[model samples]
Target: MLDVLVIGGGPAGSTAATLLARKGFSVRLLERDKFPRFQIGESLLPYNNDLFDRLGVSDELKRGEYFPKYGAHFVTGDGRTEFTFRFDRILPPEHQRSFQVRRSEFDHLLLRNAAASGVDVREETPVTSVRLENESCFVRVASGEEIEARFVIDGSGHASLLGSRTGKKSDIASLKKIAVFAHYRGVEKPKGRDAGNTTIVVIRDGWFWLIPVTGELMSVGLVVDRDHFVNCGLSAEELLERSIAATPFVAERMKSAGRVTQVYSRKDFSYRVRDLVGKRFALIGDAAGFLDPIFSTGVYMAMKSADIAADAVEARLRKGSMRGLERYERDMTRALGRYFHFISNFYRREFLEVFLQPSNRFGLLHAIVRILAGNVFGAAGDRLKLALFFVLVRIQKRRPVIARPIRWEALPRAASL
Candidate 1:
């Protein structure tokens, strides 16, 4: 039997497979899709830099020519308020910068790194069924090939292979939004260090994300309430265009731009699994949960979870107990909770007031910057930072606001999807 079987070749699966293989465990990773496939979530957080080093891919990534992102820029729909959160100013020097990458190239790089580290990687091998029996997992692939492993990792992303099979997947009602996105050329970009910074344009209905993946290409996406899009009756392309037109900052930047990819849409994207681990299996990455992309935490969280999960799996194999796995689940839950707390309140006026018009009083801005830098876990110092952030939120709620309320508005009659 193989020591481990990973049911995806994305960052999570590849990370876990690489780590386990490096530790001398036999790992086989099956990927449903081949590499170089189109994927979104191009923006990455600084914390990922550490993971890359741990996986020995830092130098490779540096040589890839991906856009170097040093910070993030936020602007309101009216274009009157804006601010840039420079990672260098708030994060530890070593964790001060990350990259915006084309997912195709980035994912392929990680997968290749895993193979180089002794992982048996099979592309275009979809897992058809997963059966857990005590301390062993039997996985059946689409080719009718059966594999038995000591443990299983469901890094199958939104497919949630094990989560769905066990009826553990559930939607997060509060985070009901759909994203429409595509790549474009000729979009206006900032110069100097800000050239790679991800720009967020918050409009009345939703928000737009402008991510620079390369010097000549950028990924532009709009996230809006699912109900609003359904009610608008627009096709994905039309909805994306309408959303772009709604944001002045985004519109001006894309006025002379032309799309280079087909517009795509994903709905019901926010969800969580009831459990992260079972008898001989665990879920990592999108299989565990997913939140709004407003903060660009997907890839970071996935790789982080994989890192933790790998440790837990090693411990479980050595000690022959579920304690380590349980601890991993708890740790992931707390880290994800921190992100969900901030993002769930993103559409609230009180949160926006504090986010758009930040105050340095009580070191709140520094604390927020730390969170934005993906320092959600570890150290008492981080806890203290988060505490200060919550206190500031409570204080902001008490202050009076003259701005308009944050409520969804109906699409204009001329709006087309």
Candidate 2:
């Protein structure tokens, strides 16, 4: 019997398996697909770099087509704004900038690192079923092979493998948005003032993400309202192109670009699993739930949750009890709660309008950005900062004098509305 059985070889699974194996646990990882696969969420925040270091896979990223990013740029209806809050800027001299990467190479590097650290890796192996018998978890492979383990981890991403089997999976209707995107080689990269910055172009119906990966290939995507797309009578690809063209900022950059790959659609991308854990089984990554990618926080959140799970599992193993899993569940809920609030807040233009007023000085806008980049949730100082910022904004808004058109360029510098 394996000490731990991890399903799905994505960032969360590999990280968990590697850490558990290093702690002397007999870990087995089952993956449905081979590595070098194409996946989205190309941008990386500084925290993800820390995760790579924890898994001892930092060097692999350095040798690839990676680009240093100091901050993000926003182009909204009002104007353009720039934010430069890289970890290197806030923390230490040794803390350099983060990198934008292609998931095909990035995910493969992570999973391979886990294998190198002695996790028994299984590729092209699909988990057929999971059964909790007695006190152990039995995982069956498609070939009728059975693997028994004291605990099982579901990192199956959106597949929600075990989660679907348990009938606890459900769609998050409020977040029913669809994404269509493609890679382009000749796409213009931000230069001079725009250099080293990722751009988020906000249009009427939705938003477009302009991520410049290495090798002159940029990842461009359109996230549109599901209802709008359904009513337009246009295919996802055509709708995406039309939306991108509608955004003057995005169109200015992508006008002459040629699509280097097929347009792909990620449908009904938001969801949540009612329960994140069972007797001897737990879910992580997209398996647990997924929110919109507006802030590009998906991978960071997944890896962070993995670290939390790894630590709890390690402690539980040492204590010879499964009680630590309770803490994991609690932490996961608290951690994702903040993001749920932030993303839900993002979809409402009326909520953002408060920030567009110059007299608004609650600093809620800035504080929320910082909190999103760091704590996510948990009652940390950043959370308090965000709260206070909101309080201040509400008080300031009570006065009619604090009303002014917030210019687009000033978006990054908005006080706290």
Candidate 3:
């Protein structure tokens, strides 16, 4: 019998397995795919610097070939007005920047790091089923072998190992959306120092994310409501092209760019699993829940939750109770709720009106920067400031407190890069 069995080999699984093994627990991690696999979510938050430092991979990242992202650039869909939320505004100089990584290499590095930490890592081994029976879990692999473990941690990204087996998911009605994306070569980027900043263009129906993953490559994606796509009657690739052509801001950057990979689409991307903890099981990462990537919170939240899960699993195995697991559920719930609320309001014009115009009168911009940097668990005073900011957005909706942003003309005129 194993002390703990972790499903999937993404950041959540690798981080949890590594942490548990360091505690002297017999841990095994199963990943369905091989290393260096292509994955999305290339934009990372500055908060990740803290996690990597603790995970013992900070030095490796410095030695690796990755781009440092100092801040996020927000642009109007028409490319008229914009703002850049510099991470240094809130974080210290040493921790003010994160990175834009090719998920393929970054995830592989983390998985290998886990193996170095004494974790029994297995790649290309997919899990078939996970059964929770009393104080232990029975995990069956695709090869017909069954292993019993004292506890199970589900980090299977969107596959949701335990979630699918237990029917613990609910659709996010207001956020029924789809994402169409691919890699490109020679996309226009900002000048030096600003080149690494992730550019986000907010459109009428959705938004566009342009991430400089490497010196020669950029990951561009279009996110919009599902109905909007269906009504257009275009394939994934066509949808991406039409979206780019419609948005002059994005079209301008891609003028010199060429597609390097086939387009891929993901739909119904928003959902929540309330029952994240069980008697002897727990869900981490995307297996727990997923909102949106507006604030680039996916990877940070995954690893952070895995870090928290490792401690809760350790306590559960030692104390012989579910209290630790329950606490994990509550903490993750609160954290996810904060992001959800912000994302839910992000699509509204009122939110953009207020967000485009930053203010520090009552430390509201300070509060916004905290959340943008993935620090959702700030003090009560921060929460008050965030609430006041939201109230200001609501007020702006009823009464125009500022000038309305400029819109694009029928034929977008090319803008300087």
**Runs with alpha carbons beyond 4 Å of true place in candidate 3:** 402-417
Each candidate: RMSD to true structure? 2.4, 4.6, 2.9
> What is the clash tally of candidate 2?
7
* Candidate 1 TM-score versus the reference: 0.95
**What TM-score does prediction 3 earn?**
0.96
lDDT (0 to 1) per candidate: 0.86, 0.73, 0.86
Write out the backbone clash pairs for model 1: 235-417, 238-417, 239-417
lDDT of 3 by residue, 272-292 (tens): 997999878889999999998
Per-residue lDDT of candidate 2, residues 140-253 (tens digit):
999899988988999999998888988888888888988888988677766653455667766555677888887588898888777766777787668767666655666677
lDDT of 1 at 131: 86
Q: By TM-score, who's the top model here?
A: 3
* For model 1, the run of ten residues with the poorest summed lDDT: 405-414
Q: Show model 2 residue runs off by greater than 4 Å.
A: 77-96, 192-194, 354-366, 377-379, 392-403, 406-417
lDDT score for residue 292 of model 2: 90
